[model samples]
Target: MTVIVRDLRPDVPADTEGFARVRRLALPYILFTSDSVRHNAVHVPAEARYRPLVAEEDGEVIGTAQVHLAHDSAEPGQGLVNIYVRPDRTGRGAGGLLLRAAEEHLTAEGATRLFTWVLDEPAHRAFAERHGYRSSRSSHFLRLDLAGAALPALPETPAGVELRTAADFADDPRPLFELDTETMRDEPGDIDVEYTDYDAWIEQYWKHPLLDRDLTVAACVDGRPVAFSVAYTDGGGRYSTAMTGTARAHRGRGLAKLAKTHSLHRARAAGLTEAFTGNDAGNDPMIAINKWLGYEICATEVRHVRELG
Candidate 1:
């Protein structure tokens, strides 16, 4: 059977469902829902030039690719293409077709560097290398059993610090935005992101369909969010931590841990059975915190880069 690659139709229920299905089967460590897939395709920032692609075998989608420019990065011409193919569908050329299509699209968008993530398996790494991509850094996908594992008890709120949920900021999320912007700058990655657009953040993150505001715990000092654990629920008893960090001024205060611990407990109480999170391989502190919170390294992915002149 001949496989074809094409842009994803966010408005089409089958397209979105198939895309989400491919992602879930290939990378179950992360969360993906058809609604979230549609939301991302519809609400991506204009500068991102985002294009979601699907590899179709006859009518069934066996692979997917999320291609876009790093619009938030201070450096220009950085593009990202994350591709995933169903395990049972690999070696059928769907992955290659999707990667080539994504590369061609990003190249047309003036991307000088292309970045992608490949599973640590030999076949995945070899496939990337054969396409001129080189390994840069690795990250671990962690999982915690909220329903079975013992979660750390939420500690007492330190004096002058209050624990709150993202829902409390419904009237105004600018404070959380500011905190997120500040904390994200220090996140370890090849791309340096600067979030100067508040409205974009609200549209892309704060208002995300998967974002569980009621379970997103934050540590506030002086009524301002200083540290936070962003929570995303799949509505299927599964939860994921999208981000967890402390503002620069708030680091070393254990506020990040406090916020995450509280968030995990809240997720468990809310009937979330499985929890997932990712950390850069070199991020010792966050790794330690996840381990302490009962997370186990379930999978790893290596960042691969291909530079185009």
Candidate 2:
């Protein structure tokens, strides 16, 4: 069978479904949906030059790659590509073809360096290394069984604090954006990103298809959000915490943990069964909080960087 790598056609429903299906199968711990796939394809900023490539074999999409520049990062010429092939179709040359296309595209777009996240497995690491990528930081994919897991009770709000939902900010979400921007400064990552575009943030985050407004909990200090746990549900039984962070000023007050706890309780009550979240391996605080909430390490992946000659 001949495998051909080509750009994913977002207007085609089957292409989106196939991409999501392969991603779900290759990385079960993380959540993927057809809507998310389409959203990224359509809403990606022009500066990022984001492209989703699919490897088609025998009329089936067996592999996928998301290639893009780090547009939001202060540093330029930093590109990234994540490739995933169906578990059963690994040896059919699909991955290599997808990687080649992604690399060519990114290099043409002026990428001096590229990065990718590869699953922490023998074959996966081997593939990355063979492609000249060197290992860097690692992260863990965590899972919590919301159906049966016993989560911590939400602590009483401080005298000046209150618990609210992201839905409460329907009139305006600038506060949440400011809080997220501040919290992200402390988030462990290889890239340094500053979220300065409110319109871009709204399109990419606040209006995302998977964001569950009702289940997303926020800790407010006198009507200003200080901490929050952004929840995403796939309209099935799967719920994921997209982000849980506390503003620097609110650190050590356990507001993040409290917000996440409330979000989890509400998610389970709404019939979501599985909860998923990922953390940088070095983020002890978030890992500890997740562990406190009964989450376990389900899988791990390592970031790999390669210099383009």
Candidate 3:
């Protein structure tokens, strides 16, 4: 069987379904849907030169890669390529072809460095190393039994504090956007990003297919949001925490934990059976909060980087 790498045809439903299928099989810890696949392909910034490529073997899409430059990063010439192949189709040269194609595209776009995330399994790590990629930091995927797990009771809001949902800001989401940008600025990562484009944020985040406005709990202090837990549901009894953070002024008050706990209760009440979340290995505070909520580590992925001259 000959495997050919080509751009994904978003207009074709089968193409989007196949891409999401490969990603779901390769990384079950994260949520993927056909709509999300198409959204990413269409809404990606022009400067990033984003391309979603799929590897086809005899008319079957067996692998996928999301390649793009880090447009929002303060430093230029940095690119990212995340590749995933169907679990049943590994070792068929599909992955190597996808990687090579992604590298060529990124390099042609003026990329001076390439970064990727590989699951921490031996084979995955070996594959990255073989391609001249070096291991860096790692992140963990956590899972919780939302339906049957014993979630902690929602705590009473402290003085001058209130709990709300993202839906409350529907009239004007600018406040939530500002809060999200502030929190994201301090998030630990290999790349530094600035979210200044409101329209892009609205298209990419606020209107995302999976974002459950009602389940996204926010902590308000004197009528302003101080912390929040953004929730995403797959409409299939699966719910995930996309982000949970507290503003710098609210860090010591346990508002982050409170918002997350409230969000989990809301999710379980809504009949979601499984909950998923991810965290950088070094984020101890969030890890502790997740552990307290009965989330267990399900998998780990290591960040890999390659410098291109």
Candidate 4:
């Protein structure tokens, strides 16, 4: 079977559905939907040069790639490509062809370095190494059975603090944005992100297709958000924690833990069966919090990098 790689047609429902299907099968830890796929393809900032590609064989999409520059990072020339082929469609040259196209596009767009995440399996790691990518930091995908696990009781709202949902801030989300920006500064990651673009943030985050505002909990201090747990639900009894963070000023107060717990209780009440979240291997604080919430490590992925000459 001959396979060809080309840019994903965002306007085509079949292409979007196929892309989401591959992602859901290959990386079940994360939430993916056809609407989310189309949103990213259409709403990502132009400076990022985001290009979603698909590998088609006999009119069937067998692989997918999300290619983009690190536009919001202070460091320039850093590009990212995440390629995943259907679990049943491996060994068909689909992944390699997708990577080649992604690399050529990023390199032509001035990328000096490329990064990708490979599942912590021998074959996956071998593929990256064969492509000149070296292993770097790793992360863990965690899972919690909301339907069966006994979650911790919702913490009492500390004096002078109130717990609220993201929906409560519909009239004004700037506070949440500011809080998110502050917390992101300390998030464990390889890239130093420059997150000052509020408009871009709104399009990429606040308006995301999977965002479940009712399930997203935030801790407010005198009506200003200080910590939050962003929630994304797939409308299929699967919920994921997109991000959970506390502003630096509020660190050590357990506000993040409180917010996350509240979010979980609400998620369970809403009938979500499973909960998923990911954390960098080195993020001890968040890891501890997730553990306390009964999350267990389900899988691990290693980041691999290749420097383009």
Candidate 5:
């Protein structure tokens, strides 16, 4: 059994399915489909130099890796390599092979800092540590039983507040972009991003295959978006809240929760069974909101960083 790591062939049907299978098995918290996988491999921004890799043992894929530079980050030379192997195939050396390939590619691309997410488990942490990666921040994957969880009732629109969907702004989504720009800046993360390229945002996010425009709820105050819950559905049973945020001024009004609750209810009505969301471990406010929505911390992953010479 020899393991070989190579670039993902989106055009090949089996490679797409194999890559999606490994990701789903290794990280069930996120939603993935063959289409989404293929789209991501092909539609990545040129500046990002995104490369999706798969570790194939003989003819079967056992692990996957997404390697890319943080092009949008305010700081350059930050590379990301998220590797996941099938739970059943852990001891087969596939992980080391994938990591080696990813690191070589990223270092060649001028990466000075490399970051990866390792599941917050003993074995995973040990593997990262052995690879010279040091733990930095952590994050949690939260799950909610959309069918069984009783979501909070939708709140009444305040005197000036209104609820709308992302699709409602199809004619003009700059407002949502502006809202995202403001809200995303507040999200806790390793890299600081400045969303100045509206066109890039549109191509990278607005036009993604999984973005459910109708289910993405937004809160408005006098026609301006103040809070929003971005939804992504796999067109199957699972739905994930890609992001839920409130503007700096709208922090305490509970509008972010309101938007999320409304989005979850809408998702449930649309026949989605399970919902998933993720938050930085230190982001207590968002975690509390997810708990209010009956989301339990299903899994946790810690950010591991290494300096790339």
Candidate 6:
């Protein structure tokens, strides 16, 4: 069976469904949907040069890759290609074919370095090593049984800080955008990101179909958002924390913890029975915060980097 790589046809419902299916099977910890797949294909920034590729074997999508340049990074020519093959389809050449296609695309677009996330399994690591990629930092995917786990009680906010929902900013979400950008700058990752495009953020993040504005909790100081925990519901009783962070100036105030806890409580109250979140291994503070909230490590993935030169 010949495995051929090609760009995903967003207009084809079957293609999108297959792509999302492959991702779900390979990385079930994260949230993914057909709508989100198409949205990313259309809404990503032009500078990103994003390309969603799929490996087809006799018309079956067995592997997928999300390839794009790190446009928001301070450094230039930093690209990323996350490839995942269905667990049942491994041992075939689909993964290698997908990687080669993604690397060629990024290289043609002037990417000097390529980064990918590989599940922390021996087989996955061996595949990456065979391709000249070395392991870097690792991240943990944590899961909490909202139905059974006892969540910490919500803490009282200080006099100057107040808790608010993302819905409160329906009239204007610029403050939340600014706060997100500031916090993301300090996030631990292989590539640094800057969220400067408000319209793009709205199209790609705020307006996403899964984003639960009503459940997303934000900590406000004097009417300005300083920290927030963005929530996304899969409409299947599963809730995921898309992002949880505090602005640099607001760090050490426990505002991130406050926002996250509030969001979790709201999610549970709304009947979300399972909650999932991810944290970089080096982010001790966030890990501690999640642990305090009763989250346990469900899975781990390592970041792998390869130089094109």
How many residue pairs clash in each candidate at the backbone level?
A: 0, 0, 0, 0, 0, 0
Clashing pairs in 4: none
Task: State, as a TM-score between 0 and 1, how close model 6 is to the true structure.
Answer: 0.97
Q: lDDT tens digits, residues 71-187, model 5?
A: 878899999999999999989999999999999999999999999999999999999999999999999999999988888887776677899999999999999999899887878
Candidate 4 residue 97 C-alpha distance from true site, Å: 0.2
- Over the stretch 74-131, how does candidate 6's per-residue lDDT look in tens digits? 8999999999999999888999999998889999999999899999999999999999
**By how many angstroms RMSD does model 2 differ from the true structure?**
0.8
Least accurate 10 contiguous residues by lDDT in model 5: 151-160
lDDT of 3 at 49: 97
Query: Per-residue lDDT of 1-309 in model 2, one digit per residue for the tens?
Result: 899999999999999999999999999877789999999998888899999999999989999999999999999999999999999998999999999999999999999999999999999999999999999999999999999988887677778889999999999999999999998887899999889899999999898999999999999998999999999999879999999999888889999999999999999888889999999999999999999999999999999999999
Q: lDDT winner among the candidates?
A: 4
Q: What is the C-alpha RMSD of each candidate to the true structure, in Å?
A: 0.7, 0.8, 0.9, 0.7, 1.1, 1.1
Runs in model 6 lying further than 4 Å from the true structure: none
Which scores better on lDDT, 1 or 4? Answer: 4
Q: Please, what are the lDDT tens digits per residue for candidate 4 over residues 1-309?
A: 799999999999999999999999999999999999999999999999999999999999999999999998889999999999999999999999999999999999999999999999999999999999999999999999999999988777789989999999998899999998888888888887767899899999999999999999999998999999999999999999998999888889999999999999999998999999999999999999999999999999999999999
In candidate 1 the C-alpha lDDT for residue 257 amounts to 95
Residue 278, candidate 5: Cα error in Å is 0.5
Mark the regions of model 2 whose C-alpha exceeds 4 Å error after superposition: none
Show the lowest summed lDDT stretch of 10 residues, model 6: 30-39
lDDT digits (tens) for residues 28-81 of candidate 1: 999999999999998999999999999999899999999999999999999999
lDDT of 5 at 109: 90
Q: TM-score each candidate.
A: 0.99, 0.99, 0.98, 0.99, 0.97, 0.97
Using alpha carbons, what is the TM-score of model 2? 0.99
Local accuracy of candidate 3 as per-residue lDDT tens digits, 82-170 = 99999999989999999999999999989999999999999999999999999999999999998888998887778888898999999
Better of 3 and 5 by TM-score: 3
lDDT values of the candidates? Answer: 0.94, 0.93, 0.93, 0.95, 0.92, 0.92
Weakest lDDT window of 10 consecutive positions for candidate 3: 152-161
> In candidate 2, which residue pairs clash?
none
